[model samples]
Target: ELHLHTDHLNLTCSTFHDVHMIRWRLAIEEFGPTFHSVPGSSNVVADALSRLPITDEELEENPTVTMAAVEAAMSGEFTVDMRVIAAEQKNDKDIGESEEREIAGVLVLVHPKSKKILVPTRLRLRLVQNYHDLLLHPGAATMVITIGQVFYSRGIEPDERKLTDNYLACLKAKHPATRYGKLPPKSVEVCPWFEIADDLIGPYGRKRFRALTIIDTATRLIEILPATDATSMEAAYLMDRYWFARYPRPTRCIHDGGSEFKREFAELQDNYGVERVATMTRNHQANSVIERVHRVIVEKIRTKSINTQDEWANFLNDTMFAMRASNHSMLKVHRLSWHSDVTCWWALPTKQIGKRSINAR
Candidate 1:
């Protein structure tokens, strides 16, 4: 045993003298005044104590959990709330989203195993900041980084290409000067069956009819199901079936808080076992793909006097194919490269030309 105080209650050097005296007298009395080996260390005792978990490795691996680490976490000495950043779950198809997050790009992702948040490397951050300033949003400062060609950050993915291009088009759009602090997104790629983004596409005439579109973030594939009524409960039931029939039970689905998305989707979390992520309201940057699609509709929709939804639907059939073949600047692949929708980050990929030998000569 290690003792800091003596039994006699002495406060000074007197205790040290008394302790040495007692030890000597006891040794002589117990050992019959004979010389003997004096053990300087207890190897057995040290080994037993060393077997307990006390290092960071032991704590992070989550091996045999100890009450002490738990107490430390509870007391705020160790932040063990790691469940929030386990990795952005993926699906069968993977993508190379950026390294740093854009505005409103916040979502779940695999965080650094050692820290709560991680940002793009210094070089990458500088590169993105420069690209955005010179080529697009001059005030835009960062881009997301990825792990093994994939990842996620905390905010949203704006039409970085469009924003930049539009600014440069006229060099005078009187862009907004306001800015907001935001969470940094993590680098990640998509796999399959873990993440999904869905949204409703209507209010055209306000008869309460809507189209609930859910997409596999990994494959970039889309599933559009029409909801007869625009209520949340009805949309939820229909979407649940559409999701379960196609996916292998997803972990999370992103949506808006529109009355359709908010009607108790979480309780379904227990039944279907997937969490719901609602992007910021009035913030289309988070759901850039769909919003961009809407813009395409707005720009290209002919004001022609074709007075039939049936005729419009027939013509719209070709829009999907056209958008798919076009390459996207952000994802660096055609919208159809992985999924069926017409969407991309930058201007659609430019078509290349080839020359042929003239036969007339």
Candidate 2:
């Protein structure tokens, strides 16, 4: 189907009788620049039409105008209202005949049999109809931007207002307040605040006797919750309240299964729309965020704050600030931008000019 040019490899002086070039469109008296080069397809028509500059008045007068008129409409000047367009669907040679015949146009795909290709400039834009449903929520902001213009349509697309509403809606939909996944991709809540991370950070009686510490995973933003009682429920209550006032209730609270981190502390997640759980077959490295945060506090805050505290208020406050100031690669996912790939952390709205102090050490 290459311009019906069969002898593509035949390089010889052409006999006039062998080359019968047929006229495509008599209206195209002068063949303008070739915007596209799919020689055997209708993409040439689409490309030419896209370069046109028709005004609304002209559009009203020539709704059924020729492609040449479209080229005239978009030449040199630009129009904002007339710019949105959808992706052109190219068909394979072996496609079923039952499908709509797609030429150079906007597509209305009802089904395989119900689709029709309309004019390119007359399409509808929309929300991200491309990302997986699971990733269409608040934390997954990249999903929206990734598919913002996807399969570009010309219809009314979601505006900034709807965009925010969509985000909140997805956030509420996925939060544990509504529903939580209860299996492998998400496991069961084992207890309230009792997540176990065993670290041996003492030289009291012996050289290195370890303290098998169990911490409330949720509220440990403040590091040390009171461990006066052997059972962790009392401590879990204090930690649970702190987080209840902040983040969306966690679904799976994780830690190592130590005696103190065990018991019924995981249920605090349920009361505050969370789920607590412990790791069975591993060490402190399993609940490493807490352990890491702990070591950092023990090393830095113990020296900087210039005090040791069984009461964790001071220790926890500085560590919380440090964690926020620190960069996390998982939290700072990246994607292609107009200029370059930008991490999500950098893209976040900067704190107001005279607001919070940022310590990114």
What lDDT would each prediction earn against the true structure?
0.42, 0.34
Which sections of candidate 1 miss by over 4 Å? 1-188, 205-209, 300-322, 335-361
Q: Candidate 2 residues 272-321, lDDT tens each?
A: 55455556433333455555544433333222211223324443443343
User: Residue 17 in candidate 2 has what lDDT?
Assistant: 35
RMSD of each: 28.2, 30.3
In candidate 1, what are the lDDT values of residues 216-289, reduced to their tens digit?
66545555565566777877786768777755677778776677777455566557778877776545556655
Q: Alpha carbon lDDT of residue 213, candidate 2?
A: 34
Q: Model 2 off-target regions past 4 Å?
A: 1-230, 270-273, 301-312, 328-361
| 213: Cα error in model 2, Å | 11
